[model samples]
Target: MTGRPRLADVAARAGVSMKTVSNVINDFQHVSADTRARVQAAIDEIGYRPNLSARNLALGRAGLIALVVPQLDMPYFAALAGQVLQAAAKRDWVVLIQQTGGDLTVERDALAGRFPQRIDGLILSSTAVGSAELRKRTDRTPLVMLGDRNYQGAAQHVAIDNVAAAAAAVTHLAELGRRRIAMIGSSPGDRRHPRLVGYRLAMKAAGLPIDDRLIKPVRNNLGEEGEQQMTALLAEHAQDPPDAVFCVTDWVALGVVRALRTRGFRVPEDVAVVGFDDIPYGRAATPTLSTISPDRSAIARLAVDSLQAQFEAAAAGTAYEVGEQQAAFRLVVRESSGG
Candidate 1:
């Protein structure tokens, strides 16, 4: 019944004082749980939107952060960017995205622009840019390094234990009686190389010989490349193909499945398959993919929380050190791996 629902309106509706509603909005932490719940319900019922712009202006913040990924073409990065945006939304900040194609020049250009001027901070998922190159930057912008590579420099970082996760994937396949398992989809000079090392370690531990032929390297991590590699692998070992395939990513697993079906092999029955990332599509695939799934929510939360902390320190002209933040991952057993 008004132009816009105000804090006073919510206070009146909730039968609480304006100061109590303000305390609830600001999250003062001293408010009673019952009071907080009442105020929140009133806010929801009236669709009362907080003036984040005014808040940002008062705090001298831009209310914006850039989430820069190598490329949106990869489902992993696309999904991650979405998760980061959602996480930022929970903190009342906006997230804009930029694609660098993993090009050092593009990444450098973004850094040179003095981020934190237009935007408050940046979450960079760099593939080509190294920690050394990032170390060269002198700006005090609040930054958090996300997936792909490990940055050992000064800024904040959030990633999964790739080596451990990969080893777990291979170990799962081996435990399922999958001998002659092929690990495919690797690009040279990519952070995913650790996964390869993990695979090798797992195979050796299982007393299985590491056959070079079984370690297929695709031109890219796309599904089509996985399909191509699978075709060649099937033809190369038509008489005696590998019993299982562990792809570096879920996209590649899709292709592996396609190749197997084309060559008339029943999944799990003829050749078990496992893929990483555990993207949503994997769950709905003809044979659900069994793979390593990282806790993206944890990663996003850590990255956002770290950046927020850094920003607060920078604004206060105080010392701030962003430590390494790691997310947990789990091996998901599904139909693809005969689980």
Candidate 2:
């Protein structure tokens, strides 16, 4: 019975040493062109291919990069995942995607142990673990963080200035005569909790009183949670509802619009609204949501660059500074915000 072609047979057919044949098959450049062509011809005839798994084991490199997110279901994280996938593809790198669902314990577990060795490096957008624990867990592996500031680790951090970005959204609402600008967001305890501080700062800067009653905190920032929160906010404001609302995410913005419609509040006419992340659905929503547009593609580019740098530094035994790397976010005016 015919069997799989052996490397020795290919080497014999190519008139080269087994080592030379192996080198040529692995695309190691040291093989002479004449010898490489002969080996290629032999391999073509025999359909011989080197086992990648064995090669990786011998080289002691996993050849994998991970992109970890807090929640896969969230539109913002899903979009971020797409960008990371594209960036990794350009480098011919394999990506391992994991969703931690914003659980601190789960996030910590994901980072602990031999995660660095498991993958060449990781691109993480965490909502749980701060920079301190992350630094402790990642022992010299390439780690590029996407969101959740306060992680001033020695790795690269790519994120938007949530405070500043959120402030801009609130300021825009204020300029439009939105005195009672309500805010909806994830838990205030989250590090990258969008725009709460900025909302307060903008309100105070505009000589508007800061009211705790106007802040709506959701359990998990889930879309349904956003809808429920919007309903509660509207109910509280039944006597005198807010003039405008600023949701922390486009998912919440979608829900907020749903609640607005159910409550019979005409968007932009009776109650204006703005959201962040600018997810695609925001554009097609009934009134089209106005939002802060984060440059997700740019963030992906920066993250990939940083991860490459980190991978190089780790291999070269060099140290890099870990500081804040802010991404650009623009305010996109739409029908909801009176644009």
Candidate 3:
């Protein structure tokens, strides 16, 4: 009781071989039902904790899923990882999360790091690599692309219609008769960057001239930095500030609202503000930020399901019916965006 129980002790207590105990730990379906139950009961009785590293080596599986992301500090990525964890837990899977900080080395390592023998799959929402990198890696191991824009024609991708969603947000603001609309988003160079494309298309379709001054790009999407971006956006339009704004993500919208408050501008009443990714906090913000709500939980569920199905099929030499899946998005209106 003073230390962790060993596998041999549990195996002996269960009247089964240590291999059987190992199979039970890995959730391998090969073990007889009766044997599995007996091992489970023994494991429960002795409170055995299997050594993950050695067990993985023995089973040729790390028994883990790595969620590679740019930064967890951003609410969207953090929320994505949370959803992945929730979904993985339903299938009795454990998750190992790694932040890439948008670095190529870290991102590559996060994927290649699990090669030969590590995690069963990877769910990535990174800015570090492209579809080619994803495609190359998936051939070696199962991979599910979460957020990056380009789909390299290899692994499954789960994402929202960013262009359509951004246009919808802007169209909603325009319908409110807010002529001067501004936007806040992330780095512009990313080929898969959808926010920038969405912003421009929306402005042009609305017959609004593409004013570079009104568009503000940031290095990060944390909620705290929203105010700073908003401040700069306002400064750029100081002579004739925009009557409305469309943020690339909800975190930016939250900050924009805060910045407006600091400057004595009431949301919706002064400058209607719209945001993307209707994260949990979006609904709870003081004014209830109006934004786009992509089916985050569904995305997580599908990604996990795809990886699990592939794993089972490969193990059994049977074909898994996993195909490409996409998450739907809805425009959520609230007090902040004059909806």
Candidate 4:
């Protein structure tokens, strides 16, 4: 019954000490669940709110984290960002998003801590930045890599196993009796893309011929690129089109579907198609996409936790070894793949 409820009010209402209330507020794992629930209930009943700014100030942090992505428009990145935001909110942390447009200079600037405001930590999903550039980072901000890039122990990382996930997608197509399974996301002269390697490996394992003409390279992993490349593939292989196609992203798969429909080809019936990143649109499309569903929530939680660990280690003046965490993924068969 006060103007502004405080921590002591919660403690008094919960029949616990101020330290216990603080522990509950901080989400300290050592606290018992029953005590934590009592403190939380008390806080809710009393309408007690902790001063996050003051607390972060005392902790020598801004309580802010940055999520750097290549493109915010991409459904997968947007979904991942949403997951990261949810994870950060559980810790009472604010997230700042930065888009680099997959530009090397912009990505490098992000790695160098060039942001609109100071951030306590960073989670970057970069393909343009490499391990050497990552090693050149001069800032002490805790950082976690959030994609399939091989940082080579240069930083903490969280991602699904792209190679395995891609292989699984192709294997699904192969098991469906699709002999000519085409891929639509290879970059010219960039042989290290795990998905591309997986596509090739899956074709060999299935005893299917890896047709170079069917393996189209694109400038980007966008719907437009997929449409263009699919058109080209159709023209080049008009006599014998691919029986199935594996796209790098759900967006690309959508475009492939469009091209196929425009040419009077039916999905799964005439040519099966699979994509990656199970975005909502893919699930709602005319013929729902079969795709690789990476555990985005797990990746976000792992990335944020890794950053928090680094922050704690730095504050304690302890050495923190960088880590690579592989998030889980699964193949979701849908209408596009005749599921």
Candidate 5:
């Protein structure tokens, strides 16, 4: 014998069917008192313990909520995940993490009832997938949305006001007397990320003349993407370059700093920089980054609390009230803004 007790073995030892043993273990009323006693005796004799995963599967309730995100390697998401875990622990809810790599198909699949029989709820941190697509499959599950995706109240979402946050970051730089400000991570019509919208509003608010050359569009939201664009910008505007730059994410800002160093531009003195998503690296960089700090812990709190509301509404046979909830944000002043 492998010395590991299985449900079938327990059933055989008790002279009962596997289903009856399952019922006995679960305290299903269908099992007779005599049968329950016999199953208990067998379990004790065999030192058999129920498999949590198997038990959860048989009951169709795992007490597990899913946290789906783009990538855990991203510092912001990793930090968010840690907060979500602590938040879930407070409610005695177990979390199963899923990384979809920000793929639309994977995001869609997460809401497609694949775990309807296992997971009690799901929280998705999405960067892509539109409202229509989210609506088609999300209504059945108790789901909470996170991050900057604007789904127009399609789901219960907890996020920061990206437009306002970005504006705040830029306003901080402008206050520092930096006029020629450049922006990276500009995707003109990508509503999934609202940084572009925020940048435009902030520039206009500061009464700074918008330069088309300063708005660099990055197809990828990675450090290298920012580095490549910043390098080119350095070469293009050697004499009359931008005095400051804003990036959509801290990862991009790190690259911008790298490129600036390679091009011999002193941070804050020559080019003030601001980034969003105050990642860990932002603080430790050569010139610590000034950034808009979205309250991630608050997002985790509101999201978990919101999901609890989702579950309660479902239990009461009422409709889940969905809305766009913006958590607080603040511009964290560090060496990068020279503030």
Candidate 6:
């Protein structure tokens, strides 16, 4: 009635033992429904919140997980983080977010468990990390890879099939009779990007000419980079501009749209556009963006579920095998692509 309500207080209020109150709080299945209901009622009446820290300590856990991404400011990552937070919350866990700025050292540090405090697990959307570094990780923290980086057997992973998703986007453009299709967001000298491969494969399959000038490369997957690249493409091929463009991200697609409007090119008329990651902004854009929509909520759920499985296995002194999970995705057509 005065200070923070304790387990004993709830037990007293419910006319039950402290052990019964603890079992109810921990969600142990042995407790009867009637007793559980009484304990919950008392908890609600007394406004007694379980001491999560103490409970987690007793269970040898932190009840907190960290999500490390290349850039939290990116809309895709921000949206994914929100999904992870919601999924973690359902399991009575808290999420901490960290950004790596696409630095390999920072990503390596995260894999090595160099955080200031102990985290029960980690979900990493890595940009520069490689399988070698992943294999070299000695940290005991349960790890779940989030994104298209292929560290397959080294850790548990959840991601959409980038190549297939990209191909689907490009194919959609091709189906719309856009032969001079272009791609943005490929990095020069970086061949590991599956999206780039997808674009090429789709172009070839569609019997469309893969003009080198139309395939633009950017140092970053940002709106500004997309705009800059589109401008360069238009300048270089002023006589023959791409009929459609597939951007690696929604932000980039939005930028391409802006650049097209500036050049007096109509969307899906003179130039159609498609982007990946169905970020909320794409829906509200002047000409709603068409994109490859990865099931981010499913990805988050899988990643968290994988980590929780590992945690449970460790607690039970059992071995947990790591594996990869493919999250579902689809090509969403919109006004930008003449949907």
* Per-residue alpha-carbon lDDT of candidate 2 for residues 1-339, written as tens digits (9 for 90 to 100): 168888888998898899998788667888888888899999999888666566656555576788888888778888888888898767556788887877777666656633544887778777766766765664556778777465655457888888989999999999998898888884444445547878878889988976678788877765787789989987887888888888888888888888888878899998899998998888998899999999999899889878777766766778766667788999999999888
Local distance difference test, per candidate?
Answer: 0.85, 0.80, 0.80, 0.90, 0.85, 0.91
- Residue pairs of candidate 2 with colliding backbone atoms: 131-151
Of the pair 1 and 3, which is ahead by TM-score? 1
The candidate maximizing TM-score is: 6
Check candidate 6 and list the clashing pairs.
none
Q: What is the number of backbone collisions in each predicted candidate, taken in the order shown?
A: 0, 1, 0, 0, 0, 0
Give candidate 5's whole-model lDDT: 0.85
Ten-residue segment with the worst summed lDDT in candidate 3? 186-195
What digit string (tens of lDDT, one per residue) describes model 4 on residues 1-339?
A: 858998888999999999999888777899999999999999989888899997888788889999999999988999999999999998779999989898888888877888888888999998778888888889999999988777889999889999999999999999999998999988634578889888888988999988777888778778888888888889999999998999999998889988998998999899999999999999999899999999999999999998889999999999999978999999999999998
Show the lowest summed lDDT stretch of 10 residues, model 1: 185-194
> Which segments of model 1 are wrong by more than 4 Å?
5-48, 114-117, 187-192
Provide C-alpha RMSD values for all models, in order.
Answer: 3.5, 4.8, 4.8, 2.2, 7.3, 1.9
Estimate the lDDT of model 2.
Answer: 0.80
- Which of 1 and 2 is the better model by TM-score? 1
The lowest-lDDT stretch of 10 consecutive residues in candidate 2 is 186-195
Q: Which candidate has the highest lDDT of all?
A: 6
Compared with the true structure, what per-residue lDDT tens digits does model 3 show for residues 1-339? 567899889989999998888888878888999999999999999888777668656756767887888888777877888899999977666898888788888777767764434678888876757767665674445677877376755567778778888889988988888888888775445435677787777778888876677777776776667799888877766779989988888888898999998998888898999988888798898899999999889999989988887787787788654345778899999999765
- Judge candidate 4 at residue 84 and give its lDDT: 97
Summarize candidate 5's per-residue lDDT along 251-303 as a digit string, tens digits: 99999989998878898899999988999999998889988899999999889
- Give the worst 10-residue stretch by lDDT in candidate 5: 187-196
Report the candidate with higher TM-score, 2 versus 5.
5
